[model samples]
Target: MKILQITPFFFPSIGGIENYVYNLSTNLSNKEHKITILTVNTENVQKEEIISEKVSVYRCSLNFRYHKGLISIEFIKRILSANDYDIYHVHIPFPLGLEIAVVASKIHKIPLVVTHHGEYTKGNVFFSLISSIYSKICRNISLKYVDWILFLTSSYSVSLRLNKKIRKKIKIIKTGVDIQRFSATNDGAILRKKYGFTANDKIVLFVGSLSIYNRYKGVDYLIRALHEIRSVNNSVKLLIVGEGKLVSELKELAKELKLEKEVIFATSVSDEELPYCYAMCDVFALPSISGPESFGIVLLEAMASGKPVIASGLPGVNDVVKDGITGYLVEPKNVKQLSQRILKIIKDVKLGKKFGRNSQRVIIEEYQWANIVEEFEELYNNAMCKNGDGGT
Candidate 1:
């Protein structure tokens, strides 16, 4: 099938959506399907670049952007007039681009598929409210023309609050991770030794950006929880990976909480070394407080590394980590609950090991990239089969 993936950003950009489009396109390309990514040239990316034998990318410049979304009437006209694609798959939440994609798909009569990557809202209340209203209007119009809509989680679909007309088009397909690189045997000892962590020290890992915009990742709450966790187990150490605007503030927070020694921040790690960061940890925690985190891909990465997870009991997370089985889920931003859950997994070695094993099994069986690609392929086929038949 010839697939055209329309997204706001592409390779070289560090974001969940960017990674998703790259991985999915490359995987499908490798499987003998033609895949082309059309994204904004925000970072001066090549106008045309070959990612693989079957995959290529084309970038267009944006005239203006609000938050992470782009607005370019010329780019839309160019995309709409393009005639090479067999199917049009749009990754949405960017209201402006999305509206254009919808109109283009209808004009071209291309089977349209929409992937909702959570609510792409940002900025303060007044701006956020305006954006929300605009996004909803675009979404409703787009849904009326889309052949199908893919959602990462059921909770995310619920969050959309779409009516029956649009809701029936929803299909839940999770984003996936590479399993081999994230295997349990990926040695973290070298990294642990470099970080001055003793073999006996229990490492709790948190991976993701610390940008002020992403404060909802709940890194602050995790820092607060560390005080309670250390009271019972001083050997426990917190390893925060990634960098952002909030890095200095977070560092100051650790110092103010007197957790300087207990918390070690590794500002950055390369893609190849990220698995080791996960493998080195006894448990992985993500305390996201917002609905934007539709699916915590980091949780799967840690699970693939054979580590137990303790994350916010958000709807999306609950779908990935089974409470008390693969890992424990605590209420979002509840420091006391978060701390207690962390202790539950850390204090008991055997239980922790069991959870880790369960996590690996779950990831391998359900969250591998290979399996996820097949699911997408099936969806593509279904969309094609329905083409010209007025199927939704």
Candidate 2:
């Protein structure tokens, strides 16, 4: 099968969607399927990251959106003539590339699959009316052109409420991670020694964009939760990984709470270094405060690292974190619940290990990249068959 993924973001830009697409292509490449990707070219980066013999990357600019005006006529022409890919799998949020895929499906006579990341929720009072209209158009057009709708979480049902038509095409598929990398790195001793994280010091990890606008990834909730966590365990320290607009503000907020030392920030980290951070942590928390955090990829990463997770009970995140077993789930933005859950994991090492092992079990049994790639391959084949394209 020849599969192509289109997204507005990719490597060097960290987030759930970027991780999903990278894992998808890598896993698919390992499956011996011909897989390729087209993403926004940052600094015009072009380097083939060979996941296997079967995968290749083609990077190009929709540079206008990052700097200039609207989508250019050239952008459409560029993608149409890009390459010969059997099926087009597009990850969405950006209305620009999505609109092109809608047209490309018709123009190229290829099967198109659009995965819904989740719908936008907040808007200013004056723009709310325009936002609503834009959302409806996006849903209607996306559903109409897409041969299949890939859902990261069953909770996508809420986003589907506005467009019941897309439900018929929906397939529940989880975003996957490299379980071996995480499980193998959890010796916990070296990382502990390296980071100066003491035995009694409870380690908490928060990874994602720290942007004020993108704070929906929920560093704030994690900060608020710390007030209670520190009360129970003074040695508790948070290691926040990622850089964004909200860094300064979040740092200020931590200082205001007299937690400047308690909450330590890591600007940006390489993937190789992530294992130690994950291995050393007592708990992995993603308090993402957004409607569109379709899935907490890091929860799986934490589980892979043999650590329990504490995450918002949002549909996408809930899909990854099995409440009471794999990790505890708290209501979104509830600082008290978030704090209580953290304390539970910190105080009870048995419970933490139990949940961490359970999380690992879930990853090995269901969320491994190998298993996820198989599902995606089947979806691609079915799409090609429907389009009368050459597919086995």
Candidate 3:
């Protein structure tokens, strides 16, 4: 099968959707499927590169940015000209990409599978309203033409208010994690010592971008919760493991809360070292406050590292973390509850270990990338069969 994956961003650009496409493409390539990734040149890296024998990536020149989305005329042209693809698998929240994919699918008579990651949300009301209107128009049109719609969770599908007709084309396909790279055996002691954290210090980890567009991630709420937790537990330290425009603001907030010593900002963490960052933490938290955070991929990474996790009780996120079993789910933006949950895991070593064990079990049983790729392969084959192209 020759598959073309269209996404807004790819490798060297860190985010859930980028990671998902990278993993899925590579895994499919490994199975002898010719995989080509079509993405924007966000990092200004090579325009075209070969990742593996069967995998290739072509990046389009980025024209401009509109809120969270990238606009690229070259991308649309490439999609229009693209030929001989067995499947057009596009990851969305990328309105322009979806629109073009819909056109290309019709022009070429190809099967278009859209993975709706989430909706676009702006920080301000006026832009939010405009974005909502634009999204609805694109979504309705894409739904009519696309062969299938892949959602991260059933709850996320519900959040979109997809009608029965649209729901018939929907398939629930959760994101996956690399269990081998993020394993319990990975030593966290080296990372803790490098960061000047004492063995007795309780580390609370938060991993995600801090860009203005991702304000809904609620990193500020997590920082405030850390301050509340530090009021009583001095040994607790917050380790943030991502860089973005809001880094300085978050640092300033830490200083204002007198948590300069208690908060560790690891903005330069590489992909190779991410597992250690998770392993070093006593608990992982994702306190997203809105619908844009459809699913928490970092939570799965933490679970794969055998760490206890805490996330917002958002639709998609709540479905990922089993409350009180794998980890606790606190209400979005609830600082007190978030702090309490973190404190619970930090204070009770046995309970934390139990949760960590359960987390590892869940990842092994459900979220492995290898297994997830097989499901994708099956979906693609079925799509091919429906088109009378026969399964590869």
Candidate 4:
């Protein structure tokens, strides 16, 4: 099968959607399907690059940004002219590319599978209204053309509250994690020694971008929560991993809260070292304060690392973190609650280990990449058959 994935960004971008598409495409290619990724060009990356014999990528130069839409007329033209695709799988939240994908699928007579990674829930009231309208327009038109619509979680579909006609096309397919790579065996001693973390200190980890645009991640809240946690448990230390525009601001906030000693910002680390960071931590935290976080993939990674998770009780996040079982879910932006949950996991060694064991078991049984690939294969076959596009 020849598959084309339409997305806004691809490899080297380090975003949730970018990582999702890359992993899915590579896994599909490994399954003997020829895959092509159609994405926007970024700095220091080739316009066209071959990842493997079965996988190739084509990038379109981004022209400009227009009110949440990227204007890439040339890219749209190229998409219309591109040929020989058994299926068109588009990862949405890219308004401009989505419009082109709808037209391309129609003209090419290809089976279209649209995956809604989640809606873009950012900005003030005016911008939110505009985003809502844009998302609705794109979603409705794509649904009209698409044969299947994939969602990461059932809660996400319920949140959308689609009409009967559009709801019929919905399919829930969760994203996967590489279980072997993020195992509990990864040595944390190297990082612990390098960072000078003592056995007396309880490590709390938060891994994600720190950009101002991503301030909804609630790193500030985590910092503040750490401050509150320190008043009682001074041994609690924070290891925040990732780099973004808000790095300085978050540092300033930590300093302002007199938490400079408690919080350690590693800024960035290699993929190989990420697992070690998670394995060393007493607990993992994702305090996302927005709806944009459809499914917290980091929760799976942390779970895969055999570490207990403490995350926001948002719709999508709640779907992943099974409260009191896998880990506890605190109300979003409630610094007091977030602090308490973190303390519950880190302070209780026995309970943390139980959650860690449950985490590993869940990933092995449900969230492995291999299992997710098989699901995609089945979905693709079902879509092709339903659209009368199955077979050679």
Model 2 C-alpha lDDT per residue in residues 114-203, reported as the tens digit of each score: 887865545455445655676677657667768998888887555455556666788888777787787745576776666667787889
lDDT of each: 0.84, 0.77, 0.89, 0.85
Query: Best-fitting candidate, measured by TM-score?
Result: 3
* Number of residue pairs clashing in candidate 3, backbone atoms closer than 3 angstroms, sequence gap of 3 or more or interchain: 0
The lowest-lDDT stretch of 10 consecutive residues in candidate 1 is: 383-392
Per-residue lDDT over 67-148 for candidate 4, one digit per residue giving the tens place of the 0 to 100 score: 3456676688888986688888998888768778878877878788889887775667887787788777756766776888
Q: Model 3 — TM-score against the truth?
A: 0.98
- TM-score versus the correct structure, for each prediction: 0.95, 0.92, 0.98, 0.96
lDDT of 3: 0.89
- Badly placed stretches (over 4 Å) of model 3 are none
Q: What's the alpha carbon RMSD for model 1?
A: 2.1
* Candidate 2: C-alpha lDDT: 0.77
Between candidates 1 and 3, which one is better according to TM-score?
3
Q: Which stretches of candidate 2 lie over 4 Å from their true place?
A: 42-53, 66-74, 120-131
Can you rank all candidates by lDDT, best first? Answer: 3, 4, 1, 2
Residue pairs clashing, model 3: none
In model 4, where is the ten-residue run with the lowest total lDDT?
A: 65-74
Instruction: At residue 77, give the lDDT of candidate 4.
Output: 82
- Per-model C-alpha RMSD: 2.1, 2.5, 1.1, 1.5
